[model samples]
Target: MSELITIIASLIALLSALYARWTWSEAQKANKISRLNMLLALKQHYSELMLKEHEKARAWGKDDSYAEACRNSYADYQIKYRETSKELENFHARIVADNI
Candidate 1:
């Protein structure tokens, strides 16, 4: 009877350990997916910003003042860069907090 009880307890422990391992593996996979999604979003934003800059430059006429064009481009890039940086920082903080 004792041997039977020991076998049953050992089986249960083994099952529990397997379940824990599986859960950890799934969590790792989910983390990787989330990071990938974040990376894609960042890339998309960067591409969009670059496209807008390209369009702005293309729209400029030969008569357009060089100084003004340079100033506007710099200002626009700075604003967009700061906004995206803040957003990413907030997103990262949230993810870290949730994971913790």
Candidate 2:
């Protein structure tokens, strides 16, 4: 009877360990999914913000008075803005690719 009890206890312990490992793996997967969702949300938010800013800049560029205010400055801003937009796109793409 004692030997049978010991064997049962060992089996229970083994089962518990396996269950724990499976739960941990599931938790890690959940964590990864949440992380990806967060990244996607962030990317969408940034894209919207960038679009808003681009529209504002475009409006300013189109306005005769604003364009007349500082043509050189506006030109420089447009160049830098486009470059920054490209960089942000590349960065976000890389992040998503690497994570996935």
TM-score of each: 0.55, 0.60
lDDT of 2: 0.66
The positional error of residue 42 in candidate 2, measured at the CA in angstroms, is 0.8
Distance from true location, Cα of 85 in model 2, Å:
12
lDDT comparing candidate 1 with the true structure = 0.72
Q: Residues 1-100, candidate 1: write the lDDT tens digits.
A: 9999999999999999999999998897688668757765875676576667666666675446764675577567667766767776776677677674
Number of clashing pairs, model 1?
Answer: 0
Q: For residues 6-83, what per-residue lDDT tens digits would candidate 2 score against the true structure?
A: 999999999999999999988866776676566556556555655655566577767575555445455555665566
Query: How much is 2 displaced in model 1, in angstroms?
Result: 3.6
Error of 1 at 97 (Å): 29
